[model samples]
Target chain A: MDLNQTIRCIVKLGGAAITCKHELEKINEENLETVSSQLRQAMNLGSCSNKVIGMDWSKRDGVLDISSSLADFDDQRQFTVDFSRFVVVHGAGSFGHFQASKSGVHKGGLSQPLVKAGFVATRISVTTLNLEIVRALAREGIPSIGMSPYACGWSTSERNVASADLSGVTKAIDSGFIPVLHGDAVFDDRLGCTILSGDVIIRHLAEHLRPEYVVFLTDVSGVYDRPPTDPNAVLLREIAVDEDGKWSVVKPTPQSMNMQVEITVAAHDTTGGMVTKISEAALIAKLGIDVYIVNAATIHSLKALRGELRHNIPDDWLGTVIRFSR
Target chain B: MDLNQTIRCIVKLGGAAITCKHELEKINEENLETVSSQLRQAMNLGSCSNKVIGMDWSKRDGVLDISSSLADFDDQRQFTVDFSRFVVVHGAGSFGHFQASKSGVHKGGLSQPLVKAGFVATRISVTTLNLEIVRALAREGIPSIGMSPYACGWSTSERNVASADLSGVTKAIDSGFIPVLHGDAVFDDRLGCTILSGDVIIRHLAEHLRPEYVVFLTDVSGVYDRPPTDPNAVLLREIAVDEDGKWSVVKPTPQSMNMQVEITVAAHDTTGGMVTKISEAALIAKLGIDVYIVNAATIHSLKALRGELRHNIPDDWLGTVIRFSR
Candidate 1:
């Protein structure tokens, strides 16, 4: 898999999308499978540079070296679009948020012995959830390797991510494997340990890797003018980055509902909720990256994320699209 | 939990000790429970300086601020033996070996797509096993936080572990939480990805942390002159590191076996063999650190590793003790 030939993208599955966020540690297998399928489709529809013939990942001896003549024979055939590399990040959702909130781990004091224990409990729960996500992706033949933020991420005294060595993630992608990362408990200099949000991780990765697309797959359709639950709520078509590299919401027409900030569903999340996600997305958009906030629960929304609906979709797609204002 | 006041130790449970390495992915519940019990006993017996009362981790609101005067009053009491810090590392026996060996992951060279897929398979298997260990320890009232090496370990171009950020492990120990590490597949510049043995991890950690003691709990009694299956085979009680920092075997008695090199059971390990473990241990022993290899299957051996038999036992202990030549 040549890194240069890969159409790099980051697809972050919201905790609510793959796991039962309302239920502690319960995996939403159906939703997980759905998301995995869409990701597989995305992989098959992108450009794969190293699509070698006679390469069977399941068979031990099947990966034989192809002769030059055989390579020429393969080159004579037309190839389908397929992704050469991808990075998948998921939210902690029920697994981490429940324990983190209970322990106040998101608040980051971490001096008390009891709080430290809570940090352990939260880490265990979140990693367990990570296992499920990896399994689902594997079942879909994504070859997703689970990566932990705690192991590689270093946080400053203020409990912000100082550095995270994503070289492993880069290597996995270069090797034609999906690297699955999630919200996790990590070391903090001042606080003993703290939670690094998946949103923050995606934003940082998109800025560094400069992926062509960044997708946030959530339970809702997209960002709404008001809480989506409200009868008069209207979904926002787009949230754009200004020429000055500042974030601004598309002004609402009388047809759209009026609301200023993002209204995320009430959950155990301590990482500033949906508003934070939107803010992070906007930051990525300012870098000229196309960011999508879509409802993975519906197949249409997932297809939009995979660009399958790009040909026939209206300007107001199934989800909110964030890009540069011009 | 003051870092300076704590007594730290790293205890590694071999895959053969805690799980049925002979059986694919089958955990030896009986062995796991036994090891957990011994570890719990060891914790309670070690010196603990700050054992607080009225604290419960499961409860959300129980972590109240301790009155300053009350803390002073509580501080006046004599403290008993309890380990203040612990880091547990375990081997990936059945959980990883089968897939790793099949994928040739331990031998490195993951350029092949199939080998890269194998890396993911091995990580999932090892992490799954790690969860079992964490759950068992938690059931025994040990607050064990699962730490994935893939998250932190970085290998040099030569496939040697160049750096593993142990800040989280240190923080976990300092805060009185047990961080459980295991053999894992990590990113390597030379090989793309490679297996990191638990023994090597233990040695690297002991050198950096300089823990008071490091114990390896395995299925066998200790290092033997030959395979323990041989009817006439005998255990070599001790292997000493000379003053010159070189490893040397103690002369066998008339009743003991005379072989020098370590003889490990033939399993699916690709990260070298038993010889690798003994070599790594010898390196740590040369650093003036005490290293113990004992059969976790026997309570007596576990007790010996915990130093419970120190009062009545001879300088040469029941298990294989590796230390600098006296």
Candidate 2:
């Protein structure tokens, strides 16, 4: 089987969902714990489901040997096993944004000492958070290896990913280890240094790895018709994109279905906020991959992660599904 | 000045120096603390000495700017400021050796599930140590960034470094951030995966970065005529290499002078132990760079780090120096 085919999904833990964006380098511990528990349960379910489908395994010389019968298994059974493999990418959130904005690290002027300091500080902050998240996953019996984009020569040119070596990520996934990555301060050809947001990384991974699905776990229920705080705003349960890169509401039978999303960037968000996330989601969806945006702070998100959302749409499940229109 | 010229020295924190190599995953906290303190002091001294030599700096718009007068400073004074920049590469020691050896990760047959698990486990252990060391440096106000060579596409072929992208290391050095690397499990063209030792990394960096000197901190005082455990074994105060890469004892007037070094590897050490270190040191010396081996537990090692041993080797100092024969 192709290694890429084994990837079940690419999960994006939004900055606002996993961290207190308004604070400096503070993690939303409760949210992070809940999310981690959900991930563990989902992975455990995948393993259990695969076993239920009668996947054969034997041990020889202290090494696991998968029976050749696995290849002969029906496609439906093989698909069940794929859910065990996943990649996680997370945002910098409050960890790095404060320092990055203070020194304009995203704009990149490394010649100045402050910018250089900010670049280093931003990396230290984000990588520290990556380590924390990896530890959390490890505590739940998940083998996660933290891969820093900057350390692996991931860079951008004019705020676009020019180079990102995914060999490490693929190799780790193939070896049954989760590779956790995060937004980082990376070298940029045109700017000397710049920020690579988690959203952009997700789109790039979806384009390359081609996961079965993509999940965006944010703080809110889903994409709102207007600013989420507006009294008249409503959740858009489904969104569709046309070949021409146009979006329309697919659920709740929009009164006049003309999507004009109102996105706002927080004061400390060096990376474009909702705008980047929505645009990246649209791009990923255009690749014939379904992208789900849901509130991570709720139990319903666990259903999305467990691959249950594909078959059943619970009435109370408030989220947006961005898919390419056939 | 060239960025490379700013690097005063490359330091190797030997496995036996900072870690209890005989025990699994045990850190020599006292020794590590001493070493960290020495490093911090050396760096602080570098900054203070530069001020004494009349380097000028001014702050504008919250960024420090080095005055143009810095270039006009006499060669001797300019040299003092260069001492501030250095890189650190550490050995895996007790943290990874047990797992790597058990699974034969150094010999690498990643096809086996055991080997793959070992690779991931070894990385997790070593990276944990890297974080601890980085935090220690940070506590002392040193801007240290951990850069795992495996993550950056460093690989080996036939137990030799085949590819190591040093751009990240150089960029970090140029930007005034210390890049901390370590012996790690890396992909190998010949063996699927293998262990890259800190000694080999030190030699590679010395050849590429061309620092003024290199220091190797170990538990023992220095290289000996034989194993230090043997009673008649004498510590070789100095070793010299000819243009043809031949090593000869230069101090204490050897009885026969025909060097027949006896080296041993600890059972858990997957990477060649003393043998590899000496061979790499000789290779580095062949490049006309000086290498110092000293007991990190002693104050004399601090002198070596401060660049004071170059001019005045105290009578009480016990260490071996490897250098090209002029």
Candidate 3:
């Protein structure tokens, strides 16, 4: 397969979306199942039709109603879709964050026994979760292979990805398999070792694979103007990046003069939180590939994954779209 | 930690020793547990003492009796042993051989979907076993990390190992972690993809790491003059390789002129069987590293692993010793 034509999208599963952030090494089984099922449906892995199934569109509150556009089609219709053109990247979430923060693994000092032990412990946790996700995909008939960066010479220098051998990933995708990567502990030239977040991995993959679009599946609806827990917090529906790599709000006109936003990082999160994700998304936007951030808890995320969130803006779509302005 | 001073041994776990070769993906849990316990004891990961305690050496047949030499020591006295200096390489066994053979994965034709699917399936099986083994080691308080060759750019060309990045293995050992690698389906430059056996992996590691010794844990006692099941077959107690890489029976005193023997490969074995192992062991012996082959089902293997089978070849030891004659 010509890789450039075969590669289509990159999906990032936020740590909190599939894992219980408050509990150590705990998986959010319900959300994971939902996401896996949606992925299967989107990929058309097993006996899936392109036609929309029975739905009570009016009941889905606070989303765009598109019943009129699909009124002509029946559920039996089938269509062709490039099902094997995407990759899955997941966050460490409850799996490795606790151990990483406790050992300060992101700030590497391998000489210490405690730090070395922590690094092993962290890999054990994250790889265990990676296998679980791979199994989940396998259950849905998606040939997903767990590709860990640490095992494949992915390293950073001063917290930036300096080297990564991506042949395995490309080979897997070329052979009709989905390569699942994740945030992992990796060697760093300057720091000795550090945590390479899935956000950064996604951006790196986008730069190399040139995916048509990127999707971020988070626990919340989308990026918020402030702490998501605050009662006054409002979702930023659209973001735009300029030629100079600057980001500006394109929807929900700012009521205040300053566009600076506050994003809080969880205590256990060794890698940066929402702020890092947005920054990475902006970088991807600079490549002219639109990025979508959606709540994995809702069906709207599935819509985004199915390539339905593009085109003209819909008032009912509950997510944020970041794209290049020029 | 100084890597040169720390690396002490390399162990290869034959596929038949840890899995049911006749069955599909069936692990020999009992043997695996025994091996894990022995590894823990050798590494001293838990509260284990170096002193031999409460032995009825006279009752044990076929191995050299060492009760007299060890009589001076009491069980209370503990001496230090460098327990963090070994790497493990295991074969695919029943886990991957069937799929690999069925798909002809070793022949390597990537353009075919069946070959690609088989490659992924074979990895799933082998990595599943790797995780189980790692978990088993973890239960023994051993910090074991699963390092897959395919995921890390270990490849072959024309069925010979062409490229393998070993920094992960060295780094793991340097940091006091045991890296567990396995025979895997790796990309082949000439064939497209092929099975890289544990034997070859061990040789590669031995050439680079220069361990003190190498051990091969198999299902049978050791190398035999012919098929092990034959009633007239006898084990080759000691074999020596000369400066020119020629091997000759050192202890058995061959009675026959022609020493060529026959060995059988199980129907499911995609990679070469005992023949390949012996060839690899001979290569390591040519490097001046002694190689020991013993049955994993017996305690003699543990003695070899614990560094007790080096001197005074005892008639009771049920294993084969391969060494250089120079």
Per-residue lDDT tens digits of candidate 3, residues A122-192? 78778878877876665444667788898877999989999988877887787567889999988888988
Residue-level lDDT of model 1, residues A1-326, one tens digit each, is 22544445788999888878766667788988888878877776644443422211221122322232124432322322224467899998777776677667766766554455456667777777888788777655567778877755546445667777767567567666677888987766676567888988898888778887888899888777656776866676667788676665673443354443433322312433666777788888888888888998576566665765433446545788888766
- Clashes (backbone N, CA, C under 3 Å), per candidate, total 5, 0, 5
In CAPRI terms, where does candidate 2 land? incorrect
How are the candidates ranked when ordered by DockQ, highest leading? 1, 2, 3
Give the distance in Å from residue B283's predicted Cα in candidate 3 to where it truly belongs. 2.3
How many clashes does the backbone of model 3 have?
Answer: 5
lDDT of each structure?
Answer: 0.69, 0.74, 0.75
Q: Which model, 2 or 3, shows the larger DockQ?
A: 2
Q: What is the C-alpha lDDT profile of model 2 across A64-170, one tens digit per residue?
A: 33334234434433333223778899997777877687658899977654565566667767876887787666544465678999888799999999998888788
- Which stretches of model 3 miss by more than 4 angstroms? A1-6, A22-26, A40-83, A256-272, B1-6, B20-26, B43-83, B256-272
State every prediction's TM-score relative to the real structure: 0.81, 0.79, 0.80
Query: Who wins the lDDT comparison?
Result: 3
Interface RMSD of each: 7.4, 10.9, 13.5
Model 3: lDDT of residue B205 = 92
Q: What's the DockQ for every one of the candidates?
A: 0.23, 0.18, 0.14
Q: Considering summed lDDT, which 10 consecutive residues are worst modelled in model 2 chain A?
A: A52-61
What is the docking quality class of candidate 3? incorrect
